[model samples]
Target: MSEIIRFYSVTDDYGEFSNFAEYPVTLKKVRWPTSEHYFQSQKFKDKKDQQEIRKANSPMLAARMGRDRKRKLRRDWESAKVNVMREAVFAKFTQHEELRELLLSTGDAKIVEHTENDDYWGDGGDGRGKNMLGRVLMDVRQALRDDA
Candidate 1:
């Protein structure tokens, strides 16, 4: 169910269609030469190696390397914390179907916002603070569902 296009190769010595005229061509079958191929050629290989060595020793490479290391460390720390929190929540709610239903039903339930003075947790502490525990519990439930 696809349409095909016909292509003819042009040559200065013999005009158009002198090389290829009776063939259909598709984009997928085309082999386009790019800059990477030119650089890989024998004539430019040594120059390319020298340029790469200069780039590797530049201050820009050092800064990029430092930023990459910091990014990797932050990613690893976040992943570790997420895994620990997920495991803790799962352990606490094991075999508790009612609590699972309540949590899942929150998707459709109305979320009522409270004033900053309201003490919803009833622990005489600031209830307006972020609910880290609830966030971890939701994340754990989502992780379990994803595995299933």
Candidate 2:
């Protein structure tokens, strides 16, 4: 398919890719794995209680605080959702021609170390940040890296 795209991250590391396509790297990399509403506040944080708002400095302040909490919850939830999506992405990619071929052909050789752009999905350090995809990929890559 002309829509095929490749991920330079792996190719550049392994050098000379022979079987896979890069379309996933370009766009399909993330199927979202959730509905549009999944990212909405209703799907994440709990709704504020209006009765409690009446006790706050002002109803407006309570509303503002609620809004703030909603934002924070949304941010945290998005990070978590992507973590899940990436796992799905990783699983989906396993069936990829390139990755699958590599496993069959090489069995296990050099591991796929983190790439420049991997920071987002990567651990970003000693498990400092959330990089679920990175963690899973790293484990797979490390396994390959270690000769069996």
For each candidate, what TM-score against the reference? 0.28, 0.32
Cα distance off (Å), candidate 1, residue 115? 11
Score each candidate by Cα lDDT: 0.32, 0.37
Candidate 1 clashes between residue pairs 3 or more apart in a chain or in different chains: none
In the range 19-97, model 1's lDDT, one tens digit per residue, is 1111121112322122112111211224443233223333234224333432223334443544443443454333345
TM value for model 1: 0.28
Top lDDT hit: 2
Q: Per-residue alpha-carbon lDDT of model 2 for 2-88, expressed as tens digits?
A: 221122233464432311223232223432222111122222344343223323443235435445553445446555766544443
Compared with the true structure, model 2 gives a TM-score of 0.32
For candidate 1, what is the total of clashing residue pairs? 0
Candidate 2 runs further than 4 Å off: 1-11, 15-21, 25-86, 103-120, 123-134, 138-148
The per-prediction tally of clashing pairs is 0, 3
After best superposition, candidate 1 residue 22: deviation in angstroms? Answer: 81
